[model samples]
Target chain A: MKNIWTIAKREYDNYFASPLAYVIAAGLLFLLGGIFLIILQGSIQQAIFGGGTPVDIGFINQWFYYLLLWTVPALTMRLISDENRTGTLELLLTAPVRDFELVIGKWLGSFLYILSVIGVSFIFAIVANYLAEPGIDQVKMMSSYLGLILIAGALLALGTGISALFNNQIAAFFVTLALFIVLWLLIGIPASFFPSNPAIGDVFRYLQIGNHYESTFNAGVLYLSDVIYFLSLIAIGLFTGVTAVDSRRWR
Target chain B: MIRVTDLTKDYGPRRALHSLSFEARQGEIIGFLGPNGAGKTTTMRILTGYMPPTSGEAIVAGYNVMEESIEVRKRVGYLPETVPLYNEMVVQDFLKFMAELRHIPNPEESVADALNMVGMTERAKGYIGNLSKGMRQRIGLAQALIHRPEVLILDEPSIGLDPGQVVELRKIIREIGRERTVLLSTHILSEAQQICDRVIIINKGKIVVEDTPENLQARLVGGERVVLRVRGDAAELSAKIEQVKGVQRLKSNPDGSLEFEYLPGHDVRPEVAKIITNGGYEMLEMKTLSLSLEDIFLELTKEQVVTPKKKRRL
Candidate 1:
């Protein structure tokens, strides 16, 4: 635990020390702000009896949750891959710290960075509340943010695990992107192809990250099952990363 | 306080190290000499517990590398061939990180001492990317030393350094060796000769020779070979010198000289002089060839190659 905290502090400090982390944070916030502005404009159009609904604001924020799935990989691709490429992995492996400590430290560091970006995007929620009199559902807004954070956390862990498999950052990013795409898009294919067996469809829907994320985001409900699913993904990702490091020693 | 016994590592049938064994006592500096791809780095990695050997065992500072890796890691400091550093981190920050990783209780003092030891105190606040290669190398050494480990394993620590930087690095290594066991790998023969208490030359996944540099040099004194520049019928003198007792072999040089490899403890200079004077050959110059580390290395490895081939067939 002590080693984990030490590694975490260093990893966290690195995000602020290097331009890469700041660039990622700034780019994410900019995109989030732009999306929020578009949603706010649509909300105004609906209020003035034009062509949209107030619920469109909720739908736009849901899209922000999906945006996080893609953006989180960019922040995580270099966490372990760059370390391996630069040979610093050898130094870290030889240190007295355990493998799990290193993995947890990197995961927490990227998580905190993502959290800060999500925090900045919350400014848009405040802006939307001030620009109108109908007001936003504070509970729903917080729940959506919570859902986004959980999804991002899970994706960052998966990205970190992928990064540990290769020394090239681009390869890590693309491989992770491909995996997430397959899991997200192909979740419906199994259900459609095996419709005669409804159990398979039920399992596929449960496996779909988008399904679980939207369930929490749309209803403003933090289901224990949803929380467990994302937490399990994070655990699996970090465990796989630790195993990768351990296997390299024997390889 | 390091001992490796029957250590073998195979990377999918391509063996990197084969039954390699050596020992380093406390306060001894052992030089690991090998060519590129000769398993120097692999052996160092195993010693440092960065990687595990496929077979056999190693004990470092009273801890087994595979069984007690964490304990071993705590007792050993390692600087790999490439100075692995976080380029974005400042020197002090990186050292502190390393200290923490090594589980140093007093990280502040450890970082300061490491920086001071490597003469990197002034550049402690400078980013590693902005530092020169030498400075980065020093920082790497500092990271390794931050925990004050009992045994230090360095793989080509002086590689990629200018002559001046190499000297300074060697000086630091020598100073570090005074109180700890140091197992350093390098292909530079002179570097090993200058600093090593003992040298182990590894070739083709095996140790070809192991001895003190002076002892190894002394063993290469093959009965004194003499190069003589003479103004005479060199071919005839070569033929005549071959007939002299204790003269093992004689060859005539293109420059009208006769070179002789005499038997052990025999000085055939008088015989050569007598032959030249009586046969009307002018002995312009005669010089004894001194064997260098290169010659010793070649001789040892050459013998090693022939013996191994026979053993493999057997």
Candidate 2:
């Protein structure tokens, strides 16, 4: 545990010291803020003219979900790939710490960096509340943040696992992006095509991390099943990452 | 203490190490001498537990490398050929982090001691990336020494250093060798001769020879070879020198000097001096050529001869 923290602290500090962290943070904040303002303004004009809510609750949740799918990869692209490229992976692997500790340490480091980006996006949530006449539901707003955290956590884990599989950062990034799109977006299409087979549909839906994410964020309800789904994905992703590193030692 | 028995490593079809076996007793500074691509780094990696050997076992401090890797890692400090460092970390921060990774009991003291030992205490706050290569190498050494392990395995530790830094590093290694078993690999024969108590020369992944520097030189001293400078016709001197019974080979140099390779147990210099004087030639100077470690290394590893299986026979 101490070694894990030591590794995590160094990784976290490295993020702040490098330019990638600032670039990702600034990019995510600007994109999220711009979209939020556009949605809120369009919705306000509709409400005053009595045309109903222009920005549907479902659409807002979907936007946050899709935003996370892109952001997670950016945050985790360097988690293991950079270490291997710079030769620090050998240093970490040969240390007295276990493989599990290294995986968890790097995962937590990526999570914290992603969390900072999410934290910056909260300014847009605040602007939405202030612009609305009746104000937004604080419960739903908080639930949306929770959902974003869960999605980022699971996606970051997946990205970390993929990063450990390759030595090139760009290759890891592209592979992770492809995996995320296939599992999260393409699964939904397959599920619709095979609606008659409930088991196949269920499998596709289970693979779509966003499917469970929407239930918690759109309805503003935190269910134990949704929590378990995200946690289990994270655990499996981390387990796979550690196994990849262990296999690399032998190779 | 370290023991490797018939260690071998294969990267698919290409073999990196082949049936290597040796032992390093406690408090002995052993130099792993080999040319480039001689499997020095591969053997160090296996001993450090960074990678496992294909079909052999290594025991470090009583812990089996394959069965008790964690224990082996805990007791062994390793520095790879390329020093692995986080560029963003300051020297002190990096050393402290390494201490914690090695599970040292008091990381703060360990970091301080390591920095002091490597003479980097003043630059502890400087970022690793901004430092020069020699300083970075020192930081790498400091990290390896942070845990105060019982054994130190260094692969080309003094590589890329200027002469001054190399001397400083050699001094540090010699000081550290008093307490811990130090196994360093290098192609520089002089560095090994200066600091290593015993040298193990490897060629093509096999131990070609192992002995103390003095013993290795003495073993290779089979004949008395001398270069004699005389003011006369070199051909005439060579013919007269060949007339001596113990003079095995004589070569007349283009610069009017005769070189002699006398047989073992023979000192024909006095007889040659008498001949040169009797022939009215000036016997200007004659000196015996001493065998250097480089000569011993070249003699042992340049050919593929079967070394006689005698323990310290010299």
Question: Which regions of candidate 1 fall more than 4 Å away from where they truly are?
Answer: A38-61, A126-134, B248-256, B262-265, B303-314
lDDT of 1 at A91: 92
Q: How does model 2 score by TM-score?
A: 0.88
Kept native contacts, fraction for each prediction: 0.86, 0.73
lDDT of 2 by residue, B136-189 (tens): 888889888888889999989999999999999999999889989999999899
Model 1 TM-score? 0.91
Write candidate 2's Cα lDDT for A103-194 as tens digits.
88999888887787777667666666656545566777777778778877888888888888888889988988988888778877877778
Docking class of 2: medium
Candidate 1's error at A188, in angstroms? 2.2
Clashes of each: 0, 0
Candidate 2 clashing pairs, residues 3+ apart or interchain:
none
**Candidate 1: tens digits of C-alpha lDDT, residues B1-314:** 99999999999979999999889999999999876777899999999898999999999999999999999999999998888898888888888888877767899999999889988899988889999888888888998889888999988888778899899888988998999999999988999999999999998889988999988887764656788887867888778888888886577655556677775577888987898899998888888776667667766667444443211100
Per-prediction TM-score = 0.91, 0.88
Q: How would the docking of model 1 be graded? A: high
